[model samples]
Target: MWRSKARQWLLRIPTPKCSPLQYQVPPGTLIASRMPSNRPLPTFTCLQNPRLLSASPSFNSRDLDDSDVGIVGNAVNADDSRESEASPVNLDGEMDESGSFGEKGQVLQEFGDSSLGFDDDKVMSEAADVDSLSSLWEESVSADDSSGVFGSQEASDGVVDEIHEVDDEQVESVLSLLQSTLVEPLEASLNKMELSLSEDFAVRVIETPSISGENLVGFFKWAWRNCRSVRTARVVELLVLAVSDVPELGKREGYMLWDLVKEIGAEKGIVKTEILNQLISMFWKMGKAKAGLEVFDKFADFGCVPNSDSYYYTIEALGKRSMFDTAWTVCEKMISSGRLPDREKIGRIIAFFCKGKKGKEAHSMYSAAKEKEICPQRSWLDSLVCSLTKNDETVSLAFELLDDYAKGSLKYANKSFADVVKGLCRIGDVKEAKKLVLRMVESGPPPGNAVFNFVITALSKGGEMEDAIALMKVMEGRGLRPDVYTYTVVMSGYAKGGMMDEACKIFSEARKRHSKLSPATYHVLTRGYCKMEEFEKATDCLKEMKKDGVQPNTDEYNKMIQSLCLKALDWRTAEQLLEETKESGVPLKGITRSLIAAVKELEVEIQSAENNIEA
Candidate 1:
């Protein structure tokens, strides 16, 4: 009966209503219940037993009165509620708070009233339960809101994704702005950033074709000022590509590019010899020969000794621009540096002298090259021949050079043989020129149109018309069609021979063959007309000269004035010619001034004759 009563009391506790569950036990009852009882005296203790009280909901409260029980109960409930609020527990027994509850609950209970008489162990156990219950309640409340359902890990991941998206959009916007701003100032700013940033950024600036040349140059200048680490090779490549875009920049700022490359190479340390060579080459291509020399001077700073190829480029650049003195200095520098000049480079040095019309210097260089077993090639030999011929020197040097080739003492390729022949013809040495031509036909590759034209011109200028005509036959026999020069030479020969009819026939035949007449040919024909006293025909030649856009040289003007004064005997005509000569601004040398003075005297004579005839 007592067991049934204890059971009924437990059931009537109303299940704690999901509110704070506070268990309050009487103080003495806890000790009495815990004391091992041997006697079975009480009916409740015997039937259900205080041992069952160990399992009973309120067994420790049995020793206390109702008021003490109520007080303990209220205090316990209040403590439970406070702990629950501190850390709500999930239904699955997980805490929903920040896991800082145990310490907080200990502090709170320690500062509270001692009337409750809460045991330290009991208080700690109750605090732990309260924490668990609080966690459950928090979880339930959080579940109702969708945003709060996210775990810390998932929330952190979402924040990172948003950040990445924002960064990507910002990058895209910047790229778009770069594309749209085609102006030089803005593009230059972009290029500056690229140079400062990474290689990918630099490459983007390089690959963007929308950037104009002015902007690209400005960018390079900025880079040179700011980016001290840029490689010389990269700057050269960028400038080279940029040159094709802005030809004007090439004219104005090309030297600046060269200077910047030199600066970068000097500052960054020359890690690549090829890059140094390229930088030197770019200076030449940009027509900055002095800049190329400056680059050469910087080579020593990088610990690179000047090589033959280095001297070759520098000398060749100077030579091309007619800077013979500078070119010779470079050649001497190369030799003094203990680097033997390569045969090809030596050939270029010789060609430079030839190109500059310095025949004496060229011959010296050729002899030096030969002494070193560095045989001048055919092209070099040809240049030498042309140089000597233009200077109108005694052909003995050229003959000696050719003889060396003929004796097989110097390496003579077929082209070298042809070069000697062309050289003889260039100097108007008709007999020697013809001899060389016959030798070429006998031993070398059969003479082509170029060789034939040279020989024909030599014979024509030497007043050997028949010989020139015979050579034209030989040319046709060799299956070589005479070009315009051949025809011009033959006609000029006839004109010099005073065989006007034959020259006219040849000129007509040449026209029939559709050969384009050159300015020299017209000048020759005009002289021929003056020689025949055909002053009207000479005037027609002058009109043709104008039509062909050929400016009359001093000789042509002298011939025209002489013919007009002698044939027309008109004072006004002679004065008009003199005035035209003065207006043309051609330099009047000894022969030209004499012609002008003669024409004035003739005009005075004509005026005297008119006055005498009138008187």
Candidate 2:
């Protein structure tokens, strides 16, 4: 029976109603029950139940003033007509006697409240608490609405001022602020922000890119001045690493970053050689070789000893720019210190030095590499050998290096062996080159056509045609077919020694072995025929060159014209060759044309003088 009463009383609560004259509820609108004026109201706490106490839809704010709500827990009977006329719940008009509930007020006028059971004291207490409930709820909702969203610009704007308490949210806040800020000066942009730079924060600033490198440096500088935490060694390292990874880091930014690091390092005495090495490498990427050297020179200033990477990078920087003299000083310092880097870097160092014509100076670095038992790359080792062979005095050193190839310094190959042989030929050491070729024939990586050709060419150049011919026979016997270049070199050497018959014999052998010949091959035999004053043979060799699909270049045509006009004084043939070169669109020198005309005129003058003498 009591449960049935509870349900009846619950339905009896009033639902919100709209006014006949449309009305909008202002903020903090309130609702309350209307009671009879003739008797005291019942004690109630809004029954503290969801269904028994319903809110007016118009009173939507949780922050409404508590002054309008009061203790209404008692009920009493009144005249029916008066109650109906004064009740705020009346849909006919206003539902109150004095209408204190106002035009838009909603209430339950007669719900038979006397039988509805609620604990009197508990109900009264809950009613009193509602007075302050609105304020508390309003405060919470307002706070959340202010800062509830992610990456809110206004929420993160004041982060720099809140650095004492830090988290990922704050860090991300700072990052987005920095990226989106339009303030010209970075420090000025950060002026209003609360900044406490952690190592991780500094790293994110550097590595979380989008800000220009200049702006990043600007942010870094500002942090240095305003935040001491950013000056730590770990942060500086990450800064350097991050900067190094930026391939397009500007020179100005690099210098600025270096300055910041230098200042921090000098203050903390935490500057390291590895960090400085990283800077040098970064500068090399920036194409600042001199800057790299400058970094190298600062090692003593920082009390850090120069390590192998230090020297290698410095030399590499200078070497890439062809600054051998500057690179050599670092090389010498490395040598004197008795240290060298890994084989790849060491090989590159050798290559750099060699490219700058400092192969002899690079030898010391190579020697240090050897003493350390670090074998460089084969290409770089070959580079070192080739560099060493540039000087006649260093040729023996290169030979020793080659000899060490058998001892595991580098692998012996046909190409490297041929390089040494060519070096010997370059410095006019044919006999040694010959012996090396013979040695190659007897050993592994046995001599190929190139090896035999270098020795043969050298021998033929030194007027040792007999030795040259024997080397060619050796080439054939070894089943190494001579190429067009090989035949050309051999014939060149023979022609220079006035051995045209032997040169022609070599040419015949080249033609038999290959369908085509190099222009130099035809040039060699043509010059040989000219040197023998055999014009017919020279012309025939040139025509044979074209028939074999060898297009004569400018040098070939020029040499032929020069030989005919100057050496043989055959103007007619010179003009014919010039016209052929023009028809083929080959560019010939004007001097050769003038020479032909002069020779032709001289022949005419001699003929006219003979005619006058006969007359």
Candidate 3:
């Protein structure tokens, strides 16, 4: 059976043997087989069946001739006996495998142990087994090739699983090793790979989320450092992906990328618009606005004329932060570059001025826009009108300009009409304001709530309380709900006319309606109470002012104190109020001193009258 096992092992090898004389055992065979002891063999009864033995060439060595049987049997017994004496081993490379004498022998030799005896039969048997194993391996490899088995199919299927198992350990080791010795060479290799695969693979690789952004950036920097044009585009693509993934990295390394782009421009003659945009956006997002602008300037030097969207992004960033001056400068640069600013950018500029209450500049910009044939859109006109109304002088000019422009053949005339009417009423132009409103209602859509509110405010301020009320009724009749401004204006009108009951009624109505009450509304009410000589009511309003988180200005405080003094005819309280004002950090200006002097004069006249009456 043992001889048969040897023969079977040999027959499984597909390669034809050279003449028997040419067969030689490898050098380690002899040392591997020799041992001092032996053990019982595994059961060979399974191989006792003749039919089974005959069916398997690997198990049929008993059918060989006597000489062949003798040689095969001796080799088999020798290898088995030697293997039986070998010690068992563990998986950590610290021990030899059981029944494998070669590994033990090598270990023992290294430890200076040569007392073990050698066995020639064991050596020959081991040599024959090794030959058979090599022949079987070669045959299996060829068969796999002929059968069209892919080399890495199995590896590919298990790659993720394998990576999960090994990544933690291998990543650190591999990265450290790569860093220590292979960095430059690996960088060069990656650069070459980038150049070769740019056209074919860049898009796919860049869009992959699993790719390491740091690695991608490193490779890009390497490629840029080497002045490799062939890889520049691919490197750029990877850099874009890196920036998209890790925006903070771009901010930290923006200057380096900028320098790289400049180098690319000098070496490859390729202008990198995408890189410039990425750098700008990154710096802006990181709150480095100045750096963002610097990169934008570089884009121009690279002959990259930024598109409208780019300008819009930069301008909007500045405008949102109330940096109107910067935004205007950027706008000028954009226009000077022959790029027309869009409506959104223009709207932002208008909003910035409105927020800052720079009415004159806003109006100037609007006029400039019109002169450039840039038809201001509805939103731009709305903001412009609001801004103009903040200052009286500009408001009148703005209304006239809008009226004139609307009369012309300009396309935006209809929108301009609404804007002018709103501006006119905003600045208290009652007659012309009513005319514009009538024109709008007769020829166009009926007056909007904003238009009605403005007209009511103008009429109320002009003391046309009846007309203002009529307009409010008209608005309600037209199913237009009056807003807080309408109620506030009417209440102010009643208060100015000393109609305390009417003013209180309007205030109660406003509160019940839940209409908005702004600081100006409160100011109007406070002044009204003072005019009525209702000091307690006025003080109550001031307390409400505090509760509402409104900081009363020096004017409001001064008016309140003056009204209190006048009502009580108390000179001492008035003087104390002036001292309190100084303590509250309100500087005593020339007007305040004059009022104090006038109060002292009244006190002198009162004292002289009292003295004469007593005499």
Candidate 4:
């Protein structure tokens, strides 16, 4: 190891004899010979054999090359000498005129009367072993790469490294200031750090941990003001993220930070779409929907074209506050621009419009996103369809959406299709309602009892008994039992037709299937029998309802009593029903009770008139 290090050390030294010999170096004479530079400079010293300098003046300069000279790597300025030492060059050992060297000092003593000097302690220790000297040499160079104080190249490198360390420390200082300084007037704090600002420095400060968004905003404004170059595109983006990243940032603070971003963008002309988008997203997270909208509106001012995220976040913000009108407007813009957010975000937009009852606009967004191949998830589509089916005008749109999403088992679609069927039925589009039921039965998501009941009820109300029965059969074929409401609808249709037999057939089937039927079935028959003036059958229905454990509603009693009073004028039986109705705790209508009283009075008047005539 010692041999290898000694060789490496020997190779590092250059000229030894020509070294400007200084017997005594001043306090800092070894600092630098020339301006510090990066070029590899060989160090020179006169510490080697001092006897080499004793060559006579008559010796040719070329002869000095043949003579032995030691190696030291550096150039020493000859003119920098302070004290000259006695000549240590021994001519007998060196050379004379024949074997002589002229210009023994070469360039070092080029001007006449210049002296070579060596004064350092290391020189006097020339008698020291190569190993000891080698150790000392290593200690000095290893101690500091630039400590070869007379070596300008190493000094230059040292200066560069020092500069980098200082820069790093200043950046840390700025970051410390950023985290602690919350209020305004950040420039003073930054100035105290004496930061040598750069994009990297600004980025480091912005990225510092535990830094509040407010402090970051302050720091950002400072950077923009004091060092505009630090606000590069990357720096600005990081600034936005740093400002937006704080979870506790309130709406007011969020707006202030956003305003700072805007001001910087406006003046610096460095506004970017993503930068603005970060602010919008921050507002969205903060629930500051209005502020997000303002940022969205100024997209043009920032020289940024709104992207898909821009629209999505803006719509989401507005929707958060139930600002559907403005949200829809932005959604329309997104549609017109043909830029839709990702599938998930598109789903959220649909939900927003749905929440606002803007089902039509929601559908439009859904369709446009579909056109762009950005369809929302199935659940979202289902929600959109549900919303569409709510309004009479948009039921078909919901119906259309149903077909697109009806791909899988259609089981998930059952709820949505149920709503669509209801809307279809409510709008009196009984034909379409029937088709939807059949479609469900044939394709997928076989209609449940509710969907079937809706269509059946609509058909029965339209007096289409056959269609209503047909739907009930289809429903049974699918193994879904018709609820009591379903059977009631079929019977009502038949009773309306005065086909008592058919109505009774449906009633019996409902009784067998349901163990207990709704009172609506009995009412249907009572109405039908009364229409035929067969009060006996109507009274039997009342008896059957009581036997069957289905409580009769007031409507049946009202109709039966009115039939006896008005149609049959048989107020005697009607009075019995009134007493029965009263005993049963059912409140009879005032008009029906009055009719019975009127009938009683008429009977008395008739008797008196007849008696008077006979007398």
How far in Å is the alpha carbon of 605 misplaced in model 4?
3.9
Question: Per-residue alpha-carbon lDDT of model 3 for 176-254, expressed as tens digits?
Answer: 4333545455665554433332222333334444444454455455534554343555557456646555634644455
Task: Quantify all predictions' global Cα lDDT against the true fold.
Answer: 0.57, 0.69, 0.57, 0.71
Give the alpha carbon lDDT tens digit for every residue of 303-393 in model 2.
8899988888888787668788877888889889976787778777777778777777777777788788885556766787877777778
* Candidate number with greatest lDDT: 4
Cα lDDT of model 3 overall?
A: 0.57
Query: How close is every model to the real structure, measured as TM-score?
Result: 0.36, 0.56, 0.43, 0.68
How far does residue 590 in candidate 2 sit from its true spot (Å)?
9.7
Residue range 428-516, candidate 4, lDDT tens digits: 99899898888888886877889889999999889998888887888888888898888888888888878889889888888888877
TM-score between model 3 and native: 0.43
The TM-score between candidate 4 and the true structure equals 0.68
Error of 1 at 351 (Å): 3.8
Could you give candidate 1's per-residue lDDT for residues 1-615 as a string of tens digits? 322222223212212222332332211222111111232211111111122222223333234332321111112233333433444322222343654312211111211234334454554544433234335434443443423322233442444222211243433443454446554565454554432333333344555565555555555555446544434456446555654345344545556555555555555443345555655666776677887777777777766667767887887766657788887777777656655577776776777777777777778777766766776677776677656655556355766666555344333455545666676666656688787777767766467788778788888878888888898898888777777678878888888888878887887777667535666777778888888877777778777766657677777777677667666654455456667778888655565456656767877898899999999
Query: How many clashing residue pairs appear in each of the predictions shown?
Result: 12, 15, 3, 24
Model 2: residues with Cα > 4 Å off, grouped in runs:
1-176, 182-231, 242-248, 319-322, 389-394, 406-412, 481-615
